[model samples]
Target chain A: MTKYKINLILALVFHLKLISQNFNFDSDIKISEEFRYFFNDPSFQGQEDFFPSYSLTPKFNIKFNDNNIIFRGFFRHDKDIRRTHVDLREFYYQTSISQYDFSIGYHQVFWGVVESNNLVDIINQNDAVESPFGNDKLGQPLSKFTYSSKNTGIFSFFLMPFHRKIVFPGKKARFRFPVVLNRNFIKYEKNNKKLKKDFAFRWNHYFDIVDIGLSYFNGNGREPIFNRNTFMAFYPMISQFGLDLQLTFETFLFKFEGIKRTADLQSFYAQVVGLEYTLNNVNGNGLDIGMISEYSYDDRGALAVNSLQNDVFIGTRFNWNDFSGTSLLVGLLSDIKYNSQSFSCDFSRRFKEVYKINLEFQYFLNIDSRELLLPFFINDHFFKIELSQFF
Target chain B: MKKIIVILLLIQTLNLFSQSNEKLGFEIAQKAVLMDQGFKSLSTKLKMTLKNRNGQTSERLLENKILEQVEDGDFSLIIFNTPKDVKGTATLTYTHKIGPDDQWLFLPAVNRVKRISSSNKSGPFMGSEFSFEDLASAELEKYSYKFIAEKDEFKIVEAYPVDEKSGYSKRVVYYNSKKNYRVEKVEFYDRKGDHLKTLRYEKFNLYKEKFWRADVFIMKNHQTNKETVLEFSDWNFDVNFSRDDFTQEALKKAGN
Candidate 1:
């Protein structure tokens, strides 16, 4: 108990130092706390079980001249699991000289326009313990260099020296795998002693009507293959090639992203094509409505782990464009093969200037026994609410 | 024969007078664009107050950066500084002489830069009466002008958008008859040919002995019963801006 108390005091002092040290530099800081409660217990848990969690995140940013540095930390405590964990979402230093820019440390990069899922984006590893959905990611450490020109395309090169493994929830947590994963039993295809550096390159350009991006990646795959016998995660060596294109017209935006990957377990291709159209000022009351539709395809069929072989997604976004900045999005994803479907709604609004709230609800309907995601479907539904205050 | 000759001369003189008025009106519009040229760049702070029909008011603060181009329209950046919900949000715009302008928005919460499609230009800006197109610097080629009449010290002129998709069908501008040729008031008509809004400018300030700026500008929406008033101050010109400052990547740091 004494040791824990001392640690807490040290953390408080460190945070105060960071806030006071930016006197001569331009800085921005925000601290937020959130609480999440689940209404239903997992099928594997007893009826008396309860699931609730709380977290605190602090983000710090400082800039000088052309250089920028950012650091974000997350600390969470779960009541049911009775465990505490700390994670670093991002810590990076970036600078630019002339037309060349460089960044080193941990960061996250997102790409793709499809609303259903990400087909080509693979820069960061997923933080599965944070959310049931795969939108959150754990920051990856790397050195990135880029050169941009007006006439020519922007070229980027990434050199990652270390690979971080994924983390799963504890046995008492909900929405987790049926079997508790043993991190000690995990296997790596590459030698741990040797510097098995990963490499990637991308080129992006924009024209009057269309924008294009081409990328090639040779590294450890983000998705882990679970060995049923050992209950362990195995990351294999993989090489991937991806292409993304977007065409912007008057009121329509068409987007497409496709990727082909070769891995130790299987080699396959996947693609997502979609478009979004907006009805501006629908009633001339400062309101806008946007409709989005997309189709996802994977050549692996039933062999796909996520079971997203053939699926269709339809969604609509409403922007009130009012003083509170209220927006709501509702989407449905339906599987063509098994007839399984999932519905989700996301709503967010700002109360005044400093306070905001976000609400998300997800429900899964109909599960075929042959589906690979049957375990997740058993626990079918969850709702989450987050209220944040910015400083 | 003398009476017929006098009537023929009168008709010819009226035709010449109308022709010169058209030429003079266009020349004056062109002069307004030229007078504001060679400013190199400008930086200013903005305070905006919005009021609803119930008389409730909200305020916002912003910083603006503008860089004049050699041949293109202009490059400008706007960063929200207050209303903590939107603080550190920035937008970078590259206005062009023709075709659609390029716009990008940076969201600090998501740490993402999104390329906004050109169609959203007609949408209101930050829930204010001013649309995105209204806040942008006016380009002469984007609209065609015609002189309507002269009243007192103001010249009334009508302008129409070249693009049919524009939100406004036509706008009547009241230009100051002074040599500076500043805009005093504007009346906006919606695409359905209904008068939608009116803007009034006040407290004109002359800078560099050549550029004219309005310290107070108010926009009243007749349909929505809401109004927005913008006050500008702390004007700084020629702040040594470069093309690098206008890029999408630079938008993340624009708030600083």
Candidate 2:
């Protein structure tokens, strides 16, 4: 059975574990200034159209005698009081002994192969105050052990003793619903406590043209369902099995990610599948353009926490192949059932050696009647411009 | 009578060498490859400067780690060090002998690794005159060659790329026969066999008393009037590197 195969591989990983020694030290810092503007007036009371913010991120690393210590910090000052905060993104120590590596502290890792939405990535909780799309995550505190086999695959195990809850935008924020949720009212299904320990395992392998990963996770669900009347969030306990795969050949790349979960309340699945084809040297020029199309499906339907359920995404990415590393990505998502639509455009360019300018625009139109995603209270369309200096 | 005898011997050797020009070219290339083999592993830092037609220049800094595979092509990892905007960004490449190479790009901000298709070799690399195909053609088996000419210390050979995706139709290499067959210069011809670019290798250093590496490389684009100067420094071969150091898991750790 599959369980036997997994057990056998786990045993082999512990037995066939190798040696490396090196020393390196590095440091990096970035300061970013940003301005954001909203398209429409506030749908709620005491909301503003323009806001400004600044942030500083610093990272320091040291590697000595096969052991590495890494530290990263994020601090921000924003006009919105809810967005102003300080966080330790990473502070970890990892060491290698032969083929085995062990690490402990706050860390972050991403899973899944889809470009539009990643349903299989469930390790970290969303920092919705920073980005509603869940592109940003708070660092997780955990301990991990990995066994890497030369010819077979890579096996990894994680143990997390604490859980971080989602942080939503406050009442004055543009994306907030008409009714504000009280954080103190949040409840957990398992003994009404957030200290539940979680565990995960993953097996990743590469075979010439394809790369695949199989993972299992038993943890507190990162997504929560809310009670409309009392404005309370209930976190559920979930057991999930996930698969992510990618096949790359010539100029074509195919990616697929799927996850099946059984929670304390219900059972459901979600999937993202897509293909990307790159056309290099277009018209004898150095410009490279990639065409992408993907579909997202979620069995949770009305209860889904993301807007990508039952939606189709079409996108184009352009790389000018210039010295500045200029790139532009534009995409549109259209709902199949509700006929709602959303568009996003991101453009970034580096200049003057260590400085970069980024522009982002996002718009939502024809919201679903049930409001599966953004709330109906605020005009969520916005554009943001950022100038960053790195040292 | 002795001079006449020496002249005859020299003429006889030259005739024998020219009998099969293709075979002679192959032998010269194979010998060079063999001379540079058995390096085991290498690590170095690289500084690249790009000069535009208007006389402006920009610089990029990166570190390179190479693991020599006996049967397949080498496995290389490139980590960007400066232009701090891209710091901690790394790329892993597993070049093969038969199929296309496997390449991945690691993004540090998101902690994500994306497998990218390596079929677009002809496109320019970071706006530099050198294309990805140009950087990949250093292997002896990637091209077929023919002897063009032989002079005092230089042996000229014409090499045709084996990959259909190559941007150049032919490349002419001038090897320094006196310096263990080290390449001194190369001239590239475009798809129409038009003169495209010229590259010169300078300041060669002998490493491990067996391998010859050029410290300075200058590539000039004839059509675009642009140039790139690549400098290699701090070559370290004493450190140990394992195959496990180049995998996706390692990339994530390295990104951090």
Candidate 3:
């Protein structure tokens, strides 16, 4: 005890000396506002009219030396005022020492590709019902550490040994509806504790142009709802493994990933591949083309028929200097097997140093069994506008 | 005797002109960098407005302070103000001549400050268009230069980067013939040997009749499609700043 106390005191003194000797501070404040409205057909549950959602995210970042001690908060107000919510999106303190970097508090950890659904990134399970694009909150506070080296590679480890409040579908209900409630506490007992851990290793030897990585995690597949305490205590254990590889040659880049999950004597897997190429010289304008496909298989094939999922997307973006301030992107997402397609276009313009504007339009056609398991078909459209300023 | 005197005078004037022009462009290039350096301490309040698509706007106000000392190279402190949660954070940077610079950030909430790696120096600074390399003090030895244009009272020279990691492959600077110092403008070239950006200095003011400071500087990035306007006012030089002022303890106490 005495030795530990002495070490603590010395450490405190050393830090104090370092702080007193080299003090510097800088801060940047960023605020963003987004407005989105979607129109759905009668086949969907929601009304056909416009429904607006607005969010304001404010971020303040501070650092001492090379560590980041950031505090972020967000407030969202929808046309449905009754559902307004204020959230602490990010409240993390991160720092690095030698080859090690770590972060604590509520934060987002993005590790892989596939923006909407990252099979390789399993740390934070997201809300599936909130937004189809998975834009709603998906991360939670935990502890994370990374050991990285430019000459060698990187190794990372993460752990979340605790649970927090969550919302889930209610039990014994005629209609499927989500209910907000605290997670069951009885499971915290020493004998019933559930510990979640994730590990990843990445190597980039081809001049940072080619990257390969492997990741593994052991945890519950998603947030859980209580099941008569007895059944809940027997939660199924899940094991997931993934591999990622990316290559950049000259102006062309390629990325590929595969993930597999094993649980309850069953197995599922997904694979993704993407490619992007830049036009060598077309008045300095660059063009990128990308495609993504996802497949899933259940060894048992008992729960859902077909047990296979596939999605493909194609996009094109154009930038011109004469318009020095304008950019446009158009893309299409389709389930070829189901004959369903969705098209989206986004355009942005900067008026000056003080003002910028963006508009997005999306339309979905023939969304049948490919959307959800339901046989219903409908047409939907969404329009979103955003304005921002930098001072 | 008259002919000899005229010839000598002409030679002397030409020699002075050549010397003045030789260092002028280089000095201006150096001055553009030096004016922002060697501050014992500094504090500022700034407001940022972001304009995004869809016609929505957001703004934030912040206050910051910096303390600097030239030891071996550079040792400094940076502090941020606003959003009480991050009020007492600081960052320290130390540059080395042989290798890369070392950095550290201290967080009051965590009660710890950690060192930064060298690889990250090429990354963006706080999501802005500026990179870490743009923030470092540029040493004279980091580049080689040659006079490309010599006009009546000004000289233009091109500088090539010696540091392999520098964001710009080359830079062109314009200097004044009379001062043997002061850069009027700089054009930066990207790694692909293309003109990438230009920095223009204006509103020059003489400090202590020895130092020339430009009150306004505009940096435009062509590739990233962004620009930054830096306006400096209320200048103070050679202020009393001690080594203790740059320490971590000083940072916590000096919180804005």
Candidate 4:
């Protein structure tokens, strides 16, 4: 405790010294209006056939010498539950001196190589309410230390003293589970709570055409087990080892991500491997076309909580490489063990410099009972459109 | 015997003249590259304006950092500044004189740095008339050259890219022979050996009393009737950039 107090005093003095110096600052804001229309009525009575919402994200940054402080926030207003919430996307102070760097605050870190699904990226929880596609992330509060080796690789250590619990979408949400898990019935291990200390270490390097990363995380697992009948969720303590690799050769990129974990509830292994290849100037035009194929596997197969167990993903991407930055991606994900298939299309373009338009479509051709909420998603096929303005 | 000797002498003179032209062309290219050495590092911002056939225009802004490697190739990083949706995106490239370059792109929204194929760099950059190949540092060994002509203050050279994957079949370059051998104009021929585009460099800046860099580049495509103008600013040679700043770890912070 005495040492901790001394460190704090020293850090305070350091900050005070920089406080008198000149600082450069800048800020940006993004406002987006989103509307989603479901082709069919939601299976649940409380859900809606269409959902509309808006979000605002504001970011501010300040820098002096090699030190930087950044703050970013996300706020959304929706007619549905769970969708209307505020999140701290990032609030951190970072500085780099020579071969070492340090940062401490709430942040988001993504760690994976495969595009279809990520099994090794466990640093941030999914902001499910923001997007059912699972790209939105909730910031994690942690302290990070990074060191670059002269001839080896980069090493990073993270200390997370608190866990941000995942929130389930409210009953009125379009893609909500049949029943919402009651907080009163949720279960946690004896020492499990928000204060659970988590630690993670990762080492990554680029060797010519190949890049590889290895990581170890010891703490509560980010993905929880659902007690379907009990209408509850359980958090388990687990240790996970992850590896991600990518090889770029010619016009092709090969990717792989895998993780093995030992948990109080159960132990399992999961992996995802994929490749993307681009054909530039396909027909003497500026347009470029690409293809992506990935395979995901889990030890628990259909029983896995993650929707991608034993699944194959195929996607096609078209890039106009034009002035307006128009791009489109159409993908299909299917589970071999359960025979579930989901097709999606994403399109985005920029216009008028500061504005962008995005469109997305999701359709479920079939859903196996083993896929959990996917069966109810047949009625959730929807089209979404978003317009964003940046300043 | 006298007539035969005269013919032999004439042939010998022609052969020597052709050989000298080739040798002079290569020598001028070497001089151009050598004069810019020892700058160590450079940082600049580029404002790119693209004009379509319809006479409409769009603009993009990006910042660039280049680290010169004495023995190998230069490492360059470009961070996009504007065109709104692409703001905060960054791309890094390691270019070699003889082979394909290595490239990586950083997407700020996801905070992900992904390695991308560099072979496709021959495509247009930001839908502009300039392709990635057009913007790369002119390495002496990447092309084979022959002297075309010397008119007034400039000497012209015709060159062919050694990497067959290049978008152009040939290029005619004109350099100001009186001043630092700086490139003045270039004409590019497409893969079909048809005239494609022409680039003109104007308004040169001399930095550190040794390096001469062009402040403006205008490229016009004949077939597409498209034009692109690039203006460079904020030229800084001493930001203390190191190899460490070019790594994947540093790419994550490039947006900031």
Using all chains and alpha carbons, the TM-scores for the candidates as numbered come to 0.88, 0.91, 0.56, 0.93
Q: Write the per-residue lDDT of candidate 1 for residues B88-169, one digit (tens) a residue.
A: 7998887888988877778765566666676666688888899877898789888877788999888887788887767899
DockQ of each: 0.44, 0.53, 0.05, 0.60
True contacts kept of 3: 0.00
Model 1 ranges with Cα > 4 A deviation: A1-41, A46-52, A80-84, A182-186, A226-232, B1-24, B252-256
DockQ of 3: 0.05
Q: Rank the candidates by DockQ, best first.
A: 4, 2, 1, 3
Q: State which candidate has the highest TM-score.
A: 4
lDDT comparing candidate 4 with the true structure: 0.85
Alpha-carbon runs more than 4 Å astray in model 4: A1-22, A182-186, A193-195, A227-231, B1-21
RMSD of each: 7.5, 8.4, 11.0, 4.3
Task: Answer with 1 or 3, whichever has the higher lDDT.
Answer: 1
Error of 2 at B238 (Å): 2.4
Model 2 lDDT per residue over B188-240, tens place: 99999999999999999998888899999899999889999989999988657
Q: Give Cα distance to truth, residue A219, candidate 3, Å.
A: 1.0
- Encode model 4's per-residue lDDT on B49-161: one tens digit a residue: 99989998888889999988867678888999898677789988878877778788998888887888888757888888988788887788888888989999998988888
After TM-score superposition, the amount by which residue A70's alpha carbon in candidate 1 deviates from its true location, in angstroms, is: 2.1
> Interface RMSD (C-alpha) of each candidate?
2.3, 1.5, 12.1, 1.6
Winner by lDDT = 4
> Candidate 2 regions off by >4 Å?
A1-24, A227-232, A283-285, A375-378, B1-19
Clashing pairs in 2: A18-A98, A18-A99
In order, the B-chain TM-scores come to 0.89, 0.89, 0.69, 0.92
Docking class of 4: medium
